[model samples]
Structures are given as C-alpha cells and as structure tokens.
Target: MPLWLPVGMVAGVAGWFWLPGEQAWEGLLLSMAALALAGFAFGRGGRAGRSVAIFALSVAIGCGLIWWKAERAGAPVLARDGIANLTARIERVEPLPARQAVRVTLLPLSCSDEGRSAGVCDAALAPQHSRLRRSAVGVIRINIPDENAVPGLAPGAVIALRARLVPPPSAAVPGAYDYSAVAWFSGIPATGKALDPVKLITPAPTGGPAEWLADARIGLTAHIMTELPPGQAGVAAALVTGDMGGVTQDDNDAFRRSGLAHLLSVSGLHLTAAVGATMFLALRLLALWPRLALRAPLLLIAAGCGAVMGIAYTLLTGAEVPTVRSLIAALVVLAGVALGREAMTLRLVAAGALVCVLFWPESVAGPSFQLSFAAILSIVALHELQWTRRTFEKREEPWLRRLLRELAALLLTGLVVEAALAPIAIFHFHRAGLYGAAANIVAIPLTTFVIMPAEALALIADCVGLGAPFWWVTGRALALLLWIAHSVGSLPGAVTFVPTMSRAAFALIAVGGLWLALWRTRARLLGLLPIAAGAAMTLATHPADIFITGDGRHLAVRGLDGRVALLRERTGDYMRDTLSEISGREGDDAIALDDLPGAVCGPDSCTATLIRDNRVWHLLATRSAYRIDRAAMEPACAAADIVASDRRLPDWCRPRWLKADPNLLAKTGGLAIRLVDPGVTSVAELQAAHPWAMVATDHDDRPLPQNDPNFARRAWAARDPWRDDRPADAGGMQR
Candidate 1:
C-alpha cells in the first residue's frame, strides 16, 4: 500500500510522455473528474477499496502536475537553420575539452541579408535574402570550439555573436532519443556552433546566490586543473564540482566501458560519503567534551550537521536529478534519526520519488532517475532478504571470517545492482558494461574513501594556502582510479550492445523489479516471471536492415559481411553515430558502399544487394548533385525493391516497396525498414504494415497532428511560424 502512491504517480507521468502526441485537455480533465468521483464512491467500501481510491486520485494528480508543467514551460523554438546575429546573456558556462560550453538566453534581435553578404554567415544558409523572421527566445546551448576564444566569459555576462543555429531536432530514427521534446521541457529552443568571434559587451556582475555559486564552482575547477595533471585534474574537478567538461573523450569511454563511470558523477555515493564524514567529525568533536556531550543530544545535533552538509553538496554539484533525489532521501533519513524512528525502507524511497515527481516531472522519462532508483531499490531489496540478514548477522567470530563476509557482501551488492541497471543502460545508450561489478569493487571504495576525501581536504586547505599535500594525494588516487578504468575497459567483452526494445517491455521489467524489491514476503519471488518474460522480449528484438536519415542524404545498410556500409564516406558525426546505435554496430569503421561484395556504384547512383529471410533484396539510392534524367535511371530504379533519394522522383519511378524520397520523408522524419520474408508487396501497404517505423515530423520534428486544437500554443508543434513558403531544395520544412 505504501508503494502504490509512487507507482500511480510514475505511471501517470510516464503515460503522458509515452503517448504519441498531445492529448486534448478537455478529454484529460473529464477522465480526472470521473476518477475523482469513483474515489468518493469507493470511500464507503472497506480499507481495500479505500486504498484503490487513493491510488486513483494520486494518478489523476500526477497527470495534472505534468500537464501543467508542460504548458507552463512552452516557449518559441527556432523555425529553421540559418545564420542569426543575436545579443544574449550567458546563463551558465562549462569548460569542456578544448571548448567552452555556454547556455545563453537570447535577447530581442533582428536578422538581415547584409549580415550574410559580409562573409559571416554562409554554411547551410538558405537564400541570401531570407532572414530569421521568428522571434527567437529561450535558452540556446552554444559551444565555442576553442576554450580560450571568449576570454573571461562567465555566467551573467552579456555578449553578442553571429552563430549558425538550428532547431532542436527530433529522433534520428523511430524510437530513438528525441532532443526536441527534452528541449521543449528544459526551455532550450536551439543549439549552435560559433562561426565568428564573440564580442563581450558586459562583464559578469556580482549577482544573486545562484550566480555566485556558479562563479565559485568555476574558480575552484580552474584551481584544481592548474594544480593537477590533465588526466587526473578532470576527474578531480568532476568528483568535487560535477563539471565533466574537462574530462577527455577517451577517458570517459574508458570509465563507461569499465563500469566505473558513475564515480565521475555526483550521486548518492558522494552524498553519503560527505554526510558520513560530517557526522563523524561532529560526533568526535562532541565526544572530546564529555560534559557537553552528556548534556546535549549528540545524535540529533550530528544529524543536523549531516543534513546541512548534504544540502550544500547537492547545490554545489549542479543539483542534477540523481543528486537531488539522493539529497531528498538523505534528508528523510536525517529527519528520522532526529525523531528516533526507522528510516531506511521502501516507504522512504517512495516519498523521495513522489517529491521528485511533483517538482521535476520530466525526469521520470530519463535514464538518470530510472537507473539511480533502480540501483538503490535493488540494494535495499537484497538486504531485506531473510537469508541475507541471517548470513551477515552480528555475532562472535574471527576477524578474518568477518572480513571475508564483508567482501562477499560487497561483491553480492555489485552483482545485484549491475543486473538491475543493465537493461536501462542499454536502452538509453545501446551498450552496458559487462565487468562493472568487478570494476566497482575497487573503483567505488577508491573514489568514496580515498579520492573524494582528499579532494575535499585540498579544496578546504587551499583557502589557507596549505593545500599542496592534499592536492597531491587526490591526484595520485585519481591516477590509480583512471588506470583501473582503462585496464578493465580494454578487456575482451567489457561491454555488450542490444537492439532497442519496446517501451512496454521495459515497463514490464520495471514493474517486476519493483514487485520484487518492495514486497517483504514470498510474493516477491513471483516477480521473476515478468522479469524473464521481459528479457525474452528483449532478446527477440531485431535491428532494421536499412536506415535513412530524415533528409534522405545519409543511408546505412547491413551488408553481406554483416557489417554496415554507408552510402557516402563523409557525413556528420551525429548521423553516423545515430545509425550505428540503432543498428547495434560501431560507427567508427563504417565500410564504403562501393567496397561491399554485392554493391555497385556510379557517380550519380548506387545499388546494394541484401539477402534477408532467404530472399535477395536490392536497394537503389541516388548520389547525384543535380537531378538526373528520369528516363536514364528508370530501369535501375524499377529493378530495386527499395529506393531512396533526397531529390523528388517522378511518379513513374515508384519502387515495389518503400519510397523514401523528399515528398514522403518530409512527413516521416526518418525511416528504418525491417525486411520480412513476405513483406508488403507495394508502397501503399506500408501504412498498415509499418506505421510504427515512421518518425513523425512537422517543421520542428514534434509528430503532432496538423489539426490538433492546441498546436498554436506549442511552438515545436506548429508549422514554421515565421515563413509560409517552402524552400526549393526540398529542405523538409523551411521557415
């Protein structure tokens, strides 16, 4: 019963996001009213009915909470790709490897053709006469490729720059990550890369508490980097300040592969270590004065100190979803200690989750929340087992035996957490670390006890100008941790990749996990049934044989050698990585289409033969810079089963299966085709056989209905709000 409230809340929030498009407000309100009435009617029933009534009401509240949040967060999204000169104030700045990541809020500005002819805005721009007609407002995440390009830039500084900006795009493929939706909720409308030099018009002011905290974090990170070597400095900064921009890509990859990447992020582990140390110091100091200790509530006083430390640490670390969740849970435990009550329970977790949902409802759909909660729930459940409790009970025993018992318990916890989080990691990132348990056995203790403590001491001692010794210790500990990550990551089978699975399957697994972790009796064992079923469904998932980008300019096909071949050797990193992830393959070593055994290519066209389900299928695509003569390419196009091209094709050039040319792809952002033995014989059959494969899109990639009543209110859902005419180059939706 204690679990039902959070469960209902999660279900309602998740349901809102999982639905295909926006729901009618009228319909939602009607449903909520009906549920509320049902709850009132059931109030007279027994306790069981009352429990159901409470759950129903909670679900209704959850829906309303998320819906309201979505409505309030709506802002204007950039309609298309263009060169926009804008004046903006920097809201936040993060240092990355050789780059400075800045999130800026755009001010009122105008775009003009004269700005382009001055040799400033040229790459991927539309007609020279066209300009940004929409009022571009909201936060835009821009990356200055050179870290030192904009000197002395920090949060609250106003600067002017002409940057190449584009709207937040939709999923590259069906069921892929949707950045536009995330931007919609997070208030980031566009992302850009700098083209010209940035001009700083104003310096950062001595602002509010939030800006001061940001400035302090930046200064601390700079000091840490200056004192330590590059390899260790980035990790040290991240452990202390949660700014991971300086960590090299190779090091990040090593950590992820080794399953030790969590060390680099601030989460429950960091909070617990910080709180534990604070409480320990407080208790020891109190003990030093026996008279005061006897007269005071030492435990309560220490709890207060721990709570304050935890809260401070959370704020310093960016207050990300995982950190905030952990803070809430830690605060609950501290409150319980002050009240002399048991605090570590599923009920406690439920309370934290409920509060998080009420505040940051969008986090429910993200991997951070899911993985964090999953890992903790699994550990708590493992400890709740009777067998586990009896095996680790306190008793008179040899020191060596107790040491072995503790080691076993640590290993067991690692395995349980790994098993619980593997599916989620793969679902979000396409790969999960295989040896993370072994990696964590060493890396976790090193980070929590050795590295983080030394780093904290170094930061504190630096205030008095005596931090060199502590800084050296922290650097050396981090060096050892990095070495372990690289060594483990290089081992064979360190990570595993899986094809993306359905949301339904993930939900089933999640429900089963909760059932097993929340229940205290024999009923928990039955959770294994759904878990196994979900795993089976996951295994049954199959990657598509062919993939096409939203613009139809990029294509990836599974070749005869079981490796994926790209239509062109040169393409954007985003497109290549997206194709690789969805197909369960690595993108770095993509083979050229012409080099494949059963593929042939010309300057203007290419054809590849694929054998699937005992049938040979031919794919034809255009690579021409100009529209070729339709008559000359008719035979080849007619022979292939699937045809793709960015240019519009003649009506007579229809393929037997799918036509992913400009006209169709404009409506469907991207296409991922899974060939079957008895596939649809004609393109007309696609609507019935493979509608789910289509990535719906408008100008902004929000797959909303054209006639949806609320479309006007949602910028991303509306057709380009600035310009009415389409571009001549078949750029899907142009403003």
Candidate 2:
C-alpha cells in the first residue's frame, strides 16, 4: 500500500496537467469527499475492497494538492510586450557564456508603448490592462551581456535597467518542451534582455541567512575557478557546488554521451557517497579509542553526524530537487542505522517521492525527477532479487576470486540501470548513451572515492591558505575523468536517437517497469508483455516530416533523402538543433531548402515538393518581403497541400489542407505535420485530430456567444500575438 501511494499521487498529478480549461474546485471537492466516504465504508469490507478504496482516496488527494498549488502559484504575467524602465531585486544570478543571467522580482515604475513602433510589441502581445500594475506580478529572467555586467550583483541586490520584457514563450514546436508551463509554476512570468547598462539601486542585505548562503556559494565558485584551470575549474565547481553554469557545452555533451552526466550533477550518488564516507570515517576514528567505541553508541553517533553533514551538503549545493529528494532518502537510511532496521527498500524510495510530490508536485513531469527516481528504483530492485542476493553473499573465497566477483556485480548492476533508464532518456532527450554502463563502471568509483574526497579536502584546506596540493591532485583526477568520458563518447555509435513517443506509450512502459520492480512473485514476469507492447508501439510511430516554429518564420521539411532542409540558411542554432532532434536526423546537418532538388525559390515565396506513399505534397512558404500579391499566388496556393506565411493569407487564397500563417499559429502554438496519402482536409479536421497544444494567445478560436454584445465582431481581427509582418515589428525581435 505504501508503494502504491506514490504511483497514485503521480497519476493524479499527471491527470491534472492533462486536464483542459479551468478546473472546478467544487467538483474536485465532491469527488474527494465521495472517495473518503468510500474508504471509510470499505474499512469494514474485504481486504481487496479496502485497498481499492485507499488507492482511490490517495488519487483524489493528489488531484486536490495540485489544484491548491495552482491557485497559490497563480501569479500574473506581463500584459504586453514593451521596453520599460524597471527596477527589480535580483533573486538569483547564474554566469553564462559572456553574459549574466539573473532572475529578478519586477518593480515596474514606467513602461513605454513606443516599443510597438520598433516591433517588440508584436512578438508577445497580451490583453491590454486598463491599469498596467496588475501585469507586473512575477519573477523575470533577464540576461545582461558581458559589456554591461555589473560587479557585486548577487541575490537580494536591487538594480534598475531598461529592457524589453515579454511573456515566457510556449514550445517553439508542438511536442517540444514547454518552458512557459514550467515558468508559470516556478513563478517566473517573463524573460528578456537588458538594453542598457544596469545601475545598482540597492546592495544585498547583510542579515538574511539565505543571502549569506548565496554569497558564500558564489565566493566558493570563484575560488575554485581561480585555483584550477579552465576545463578542470568548470567540472570541479559542478562537482562541489552544483553549479554547471561554468561547464562548457562541449564537456557537457561529452559527459552526456559517455553516460557520466550524472556525475556532473549533485544527486543521489553524490549524497549517498558523502553520507557513507562521513559515517565510515567517524566510526574509524571512534574505534581508535576501543573503550569509547565499546562503551558508547558509536554507530548512532556517526549516523547523527552523517545526517547533519548530508543536510549541510544539500544546502551548500543549493538544495536542488534531486538533491533534496536524495537527502530525504539518506536521512531514512541514517535513521535505519540508528534504529537497527533495514532501510534500503522500495518503501524508503516511496517516502522520498511522496515528500517531493507533496512539496514540488510539478517536478514529477520533469526529466530530473523521473531519471533520479528511476535509477534508484532499478538499483534497489536488482539488489532485492534473490539470485543477485545469493550470488553476492559473503563467503570464504580467494582474494582474487572475490575481487573478480565484485567487479562482475558492478558491471551487472550498471547494465541493469542503463537498461531501465534508456526509455526515459529517449523520451526526454531524444537519445540514450550506448556505452554508459561500461563508462560508469570506471567513472562512478573514480568520482565517489577519489575526486570528491580530494575536492572536499581541498575546500577544507583553502581556509588555512594551504589548498594548492589538494587542488592539484583534484585537477589531475578531473582530467582523467574527462579523458575517460571523451574516449568512450567518441566511439562509433556512442548514442542512439529516437523520435518522441506518445504519452500513452511512455506510460505503458513506465507501468510495466514499476510492476516488474515492485512485485516479488512470479506475477512480476507478466510485466514483460506490456514492456514489449510499449516498445512495439514506439517502433510503429513515425516522425513528422515538416516543422514550423511558433512565429511561422522558420520552417523545415524532411526530403526524400531523409535530410532536413530549412527555409532560412541563416537560422538560429537553437532552431536548427531542435529541428534536427525532432526529425531524428541529428547526425545529418540541415541544408537550405532551395539547395534540394525540385525546389524553387523566387523573390516572394518558395515551393518544395515531397513524395510520400506515391502521393505528391507541395509546401509553399512566403519569403521575408514586404508584400506578395494574393491574386498572383492564388493558383499556386490552391494547388499546394500546405500554405504557410508570416502574414495572413486572403480569404480566396485557401490551401488544400493546412494554413499555418501567423493567425493560425498564434492559436496552435506550433505545428508538426506528418504528410499522409489521405491527409486532413480542413482546419477543423486538423484541430480535432491534433487538438490545441497550448493556450498561446488571448484570441478565442471559437465563436463568441450569440447573446454577447461582441458576437458580431471577429476575434481574429485583433493583432496576432507573434505576428511581425510589418517592417517595424519585423525588425524588432529576430527570434
């Protein structure tokens, strides 16, 4: 029952996210009340009935928690896009490549609609407020280039600057990661870049513990960076402080490909290692005095010390979600040691998950939470297996034989963990490391036993100005770790990319995995059936052939040769990379659309033809010109299967199927269409099939009520949120 509670909570949270429109609290309350009553009544019934009632009640409670959380996090976003002279307090600061990214609480003293003439207002149009103060309600992420970097800017420091603020953008393409939803729940309403140099208005407070910790962390990062060389400095900081902001993209990719990415982050492995080392050392020192060790409860004392150290490490490293989750589990293990009971079980994992779901419910949807929990669960399940237990049991054996046995066990566990995490990796990242298991067998022990301890000692020695020796050892170890990562990652076929799978398919796999892990009897083997089915379903799915950005400026088409061709040769790297990922052609570079055979480009528009299943489909997209005559393009538009442009097409210029102009895209967020021999005929059919991916704009896609005073008015008549057809707004925001 304890194991099932976290599953029920996750289901409820996922359901809340999948729910469309506003949720009614009264309905949820009623349902929860009914479930509670059922549980009480079933208390007098059979065991199965009671179990079912408890599970239903848990689900209801999960839903209620999310609903309540939404209300608490309902901070208002920016009402419109405009350049403003704003004053804000910096909540956090992260160093970026040649820039400083900071999250700030906005204090809007004035705003200017003059940005409208410059096109900034077009990219993020929101409903105008009669009074604008209601719009400046939440945190905003602002990036300041190095030229404007202000020294001594830390958390709690207030600064004033002129910047163009826009609401957080939705997914640029359908089925892509949605940053806007994440921002909403995290209390960040907007993102922008500073236009002018920032002027410090107020200094960081000297009294608050949070501010002190922030400053200390920043100081430590700076110290480590100064002590070590560039590559080693970045990795060292990440290992000690959970600050990946200093890590270069190349190194990050290498770690990810080599399956050593988890080492770069402070998570379960790091926490557990720290706790174990602390207790081990404490017990060893205590045993030096045999009287003290025998007279006192040394193990309990060590457990208590380990708990304190774990909490300190968690806080010093910023207490990220995964760290906090692992800290909870570590505390449980420490408790077990103190109380003389077994603690490393599924129940311990469930308790940790339950705490996270209750506090940071949104994390359940993110990759970090999913991956961390999945890895730990798989490891625990393997350990609990009877065959694994008997094989690894302590016995009289030769030293060399025992050493080989331990090595074999390590490799076997790594294989099992990598297999468990592969599907999740593909689901979120579109790729999984092929040789991660072998790489980790070397990397994990190196990180746990050698590097981390050296770094910790170096940090401790830094206080007395004697850390150079330790830092040198640490740097050498980090270099060795990097060598292993690059060596393994550079191997042929180090990573495999898969297209995104449907939510249903992913859920089936997750359920099957959980069933296999949670159960102990022969019934657990039945999970193989659903796992196979999910894998088949994923294999059956196809990637969309065409991609459109939310702004309708960038379009990509996968040609017959399976290479993606982009509309703009000089598109942003982010757009190109995302297109490659989603199209499952990341290994191949995207070419200019006009470079493809049988594609034509004119001054006004470009046309590309694709042959799919023996049927020809034409895609027509307008160039970035001021105007194109609808009358001249009517014949071509009518013949094409897909018509897309930055501007709205005329009524008579209807395409055979899709119309992905700014107006349509504003409502749909972004579109990824897979061409079929028999495709969707009308906009209504497409809407019904795909549904709306996001509530991107304020404009209503449906007809207004007949009795309403604005019924006769067309909602589409308003300026589209991301439309930049006019020259002024066109030059405002390129992205």
Candidate 3:
C-alpha cells in the first residue's frame, strides 16, 4: 500500500488538474500540497529515505518537464495588444486536401516592435493548438504556409509571420456534442483564419519514427479492411492493435451497449494477456534448453517482448492517455523482471505514473487515465491477497471451477472499474446499461480467445497473403458475438435512461464503489453499498424533472417558470414525433402564459432571458398543439400567445423575428429566438401601431437556467383551469 501510495497521489493530482474546474482546481491544489509535504518528510528522513526522496523529486521534476514541453509545443505565436509584424517559427504544419494551417510558436511575443519583451506579465494570449484552452505563451496559429513560396515549413522549422490572435469558440450546439472541448483535449493548435507569408529558415527532415509508425498503421488498416468484411476489419484491427477508428459509429454504439467497447480499448486485459503469454513461453523455451539455463535470458526476452507490445499498442492508438498509461505500467513491470527485482515496487509504479503525468498533464483530467489505473490497481490488490497463489503456482484444479473463478474475477474487475467511472459516465452520457455485467460476461472471453489471437496471427500472415482467411474467420466470429451482446443489450428494458443525476449523487456512487472494490473485511458486504445507492438514485429520478416534454417526446423548456415560450428544434419526424409522445404523457394541451416557470416575459407572453440576445420567443409547435396553458405562454414575437410560422408574423414582428431566424436569413449559424410582449399591447396602441415600439429584434441575454429542477418534462394544464381548450386553437393561425 505504501509503495502504491505515491502513484495514487499522482493519479489523484492528475484527476485534479485534468478538469480545470473549481472542484478540479481544489483537488489539484490539495494534492500538490500533499505531495510537497510527502517530499519534505522523505527528504528529512535519513539515508535510504533521502535517496528515495531524491529519486521521487527527480521523477516529479521530470513529469513537470514533459508537461511544460507539451504545452509549449502547442502554444500559439501572436503579438500582444499593439500592432507588430512579429517573427515566429512554424511549430506544426497540418495538411488537408482543401486547405492547411500552421501552428506557430511565437518567440519573445511583445506588445511593440520597439525591441520590447513580453516579460511574462502580458495578459494577452496568442493563437494556440487546442484553441479552447489558454495559450501557454510562446505559441499560436496562422494560415497554412504556402509551400512553394516558402523555402520549407515543417516542425522544428523557424519562419516569420504576422497573425492575429482570436478566442476559441465556446458555444455547444443546443443538443449536440461539444467539439471545442474535444479539439482542446487532442491539443489541436488554433482553428485560425490568419494565413500569411511564411519564409522557412530551416528545412525539416522527411520522416520521423512517429511518421513511420503512422504510415505502418495506415498500411495495416488498409490490409485488414481488404481482408475482412463490414465490421470484421474493425474488430480485427482493434484486437491486434487497439485501432477502432475504422469501425462504423453504429457498430461502435452497438459494442458500447453490449459493454464490449472495453475489449477494443488497450487496457489491463490486453496487457495482461500479452505479458502472460511472453513470460510462459520465455520460461518454457529457456527451461527446455538446460545447457543454456545459466544464460537463458528468460526475463530479458519476456521484458523485451512486453516492451515491444506496449510500444506497438501505444503506436497504434496514437499515444492516447489510457493506452500510454497501460504501456508505461507494462514497461515498468517488464523492466523490474529483467533487472531480477520484484515485478513492481510502490516507488517504481509511482515513478512511472509521475513520468506519464508530468509529460501529459492534461491526462490528469481524463477518464481514460483514471479508469485504466483504477482497474490496474484493483487487479494488483487482488493479486496481493495471496489467496490465489496456488492458482498461478499449480494448475491442479478442474476446468469448471477454474472457469467459475475466472468469471468471478472478470465480473468483479468490471464492477470495480465501472463503479469508479460511473459518475463521469452518467454526467457525460445520461445512460446506464441495466445488464452491463451480463454484457461484459460474454464479450470478454470471446475477445480473448477468438478476436485478439487471430488478430496477432493475421498481422504476420497478411505479409504473405496467408492470414486473410484466418482474420476473416475471426472477424466474423467476433462480429457475431458482438451482435449477440448488442441484441441482448437492446432486449426489453435493457437500457434505462435517467436523464442525468446530481454531482453529489455521482460522487457518492464513486466513493461507494471504490470502497467496495478495495474493501478487505466482509468485502462482499460492502458491495451492497454501491448497489443500494444506485437503486436509491434510480428511484429519485424523474424524466419530467429534466426535460421540457411535448407529447411523449423530449422538447425544450424556457423561462424560469412556464411564463416563457417553448422553442423546439425542428429536425425530423423521429425527433418531433417522439417529443410529441413525451408531452402527451403529461396531458399537456397548451402551456399557460403565466406558467412559464421562473420567467419574466414582456407585455404579451414572451419569455425574457438574459441570454446573448436578452430575449426569447415563446415555443409554438407547427405540428403538435402547444401543450402549455395560454396563461403560461409569454408574449413572444409580438403576437398572440400562440406562435405562427415565419411568413405569418405581423409586419412589426418581421424585423424582430427575422433577426431571430438567422438561419433563414443566412446571417447566423445558430438558432436565436426573439422575445416580445405581444399580448401586452393595448387595443388603442395596436390600432395606432406603425413600428409598434413594441417590436423587438434580437434577444438581449439568454439567462442560464438556475431554477431548481431545471429540467421539466411536460407541463399539463394547471389543475382545474378556468377553461380547458382541447384543441388549443387560436383561430385561423393554427397550422
């Protein structure tokens, strides 16, 4: 435990700084202070402790160095506030068929061209890769360099350019994924529009190992795809090298539903299998030739193979956080064996983890790193118990019990690791597989026996065109198993959606799960805790509490209360029809103007939000009847409580509504609804209306939904309303 402690601290810190939020910052700061104190204690301790302490310090420093270099590599080059033609170097040149972009590392970025220095006090940022994240000084981006015009532009190539620094985009589409964060996670230099002259001062070499590895992978993928059918190639590639990029999204989704996605991820399973195979063969081959026993090199052979496998997997996966972590751990284990030491010391594990965190600090925040290490740590704990000593020492047990024990451990490991990531999984996906355990049960063995082995053989056989048939067979078998997994997963009541849970609940789930996994006493008893908490959480959830419902499908909610209008993103029948079903479940005929929850609307029933435009239009459906009560409706679009299509809006409403419909006007790329107090106008004013002073353009600011129970599914007519309009018809305006 003591040996593993430092690694835990490293992991914890990585977890801390990884998120870059208030909680993440707090965790990071606390963990860093704790590490410092530990270092101090170790330093004060005499002799051996001091040596260990120094080594730890070096490892820590090394980690920091790696992180700093990575950040620098992605930093942008740009001048500060003042205008200046700054000299910079082309940090990276990425080519796309249509266009290209150059990531630049600015040197001595300054506000003026008067030989001034930035001096690290400048607050202005330059362009950078990973646009959403802050530029770590000395880096930015520009338009793709002109190749023929510029002598040469490549990595390590210095060139001069003038560029403007722009902020990264922050908005996530209303109901879509956030690509900004994805790009930032991948460390993409700025998404820039500044393309200018770049005169290369030095030429870069043709290819590097990373470059060669990429080409090899491409060749392998092409070979495998040609040999396998449909989903077969993806499965084969994934088993062999952990590459699943070629897998179709639909197949990927199916794999996920079946809990088979982990099989494709380079994790403890693959590492363990490879390590076991290498060690067994090494011991056997060496033991058989007793004459060479003195110089058998068993450990060396095993270690070398392990290192190769780890490196190969990392190469195929492009050094992703989890894959890197696994590879590092594997290398650490192999190194220990080769050196005639124990497989791992607490210190060695910590050093490896620190090294990884230092170089790729951003991984400290990613789920992959956390889950990978968590799973690995759990396995280490299991091995340490020594109860399974004979299981490895001798194989006298029957195959049946061995199979059962294996099943138990596999299921247990999945439970432990899944428990660790459950909170994040829920926060990000809002989905839980009710029978995830069952799904993993079938997926793991099939992957181990048929998929990965065939994949390894196929790679070798492909060179001579002899492995295609074997790979094809493996792919089809794996696909069939995957199909079973997905089919079973989709069976009645297989997946249970819980909108989303609170962070507190997620935290509880995480803690309870870890406690259960690491518990030593009545360990089985502790398992009940996470299960119970999960059950309680499930019971506490309500769909209407999180969604604005229309009919029986999902819709959007606005305003603090119901006093605002409803706006549905018009996509397709599946989307609209499902939403209608969801709304109907709550028996909503029309949203009441006064019932726009927590909203302050205009003279009419338009909802008022503090969003960018400061206004919001009442949501009116062209298809489904407005389930909101008329009282709850806001005076949106400066018209009646009910909203009409774009062509039907009154003359005064056109300008305001047009501004909202930027998509229709082809002026904006987003949906912005305009809010108005249409129902507030007096008849006298309506009769005298010209511009109608009441007409509004864009909204002022859309307020963040801060109300309790921020999500609402369906808004049924207030019980015992003054009148119930079944049709909710507003005369000729009804669509």
Q: What C-alpha lDDT values do all the predictions have?
A: 0.73, 0.74, 0.47
In model 3, what lDDT does residue 300 have?
85
Best prediction by TM-score: 2
In candidate 1, what residue range of length 10 has the lowest lDDT sum? 726-735
* Model 1: per-residue Cα lDDT over 351-399, one tens digit each: 9889999998888888888888888878887887889999986778999
lDDT of 3: 0.47
TM-score of each: 0.86, 0.88, 0.60
Over the stretch 1-735, how does candidate 2's per-residue lDDT look in tens digits? 568888888877766665542344445546766876776686777776677677777777777788667655634555546676667778777665312344344434333456433223323333232222223355678878767768868888788888877767767775666676677677666678888888988888887889888888888888888898888888889888888877877788799889999998999889988899999999999989989988999999999989998998899898888899989989998998899999998898898889999998888878888999999899899999999999987779999999988989999989999989998988877788889999998999999999999999999998999988999899999999999998998898898878667667888899899999988999999888888888899889877788888788988887776688988877877788778777766634689888977677765678876766655566788868666655457767776667888777777777655677877776665677776423221122222211112344565363212113342122213533133222222111111
Candidate 2, run of 10 with poorest lDDT = 726-735
Show the colliding residue pairs in model 1.
Answer: none
Stretches of model 2 off by over 4 angstroms after superposition: 22-44, 97-136, 602-604, 629-632, 677-735
Off by over 4 Å in 3: 1-177, 189-207, 279-288, 339-356, 382-395, 398-401, 408-421, 516-735
lDDT of 3 by residue, 565-610 (tens): 3443333443332222222211122343334454333322233222
Cα deviation of 709, candidate 1, in Å: 26
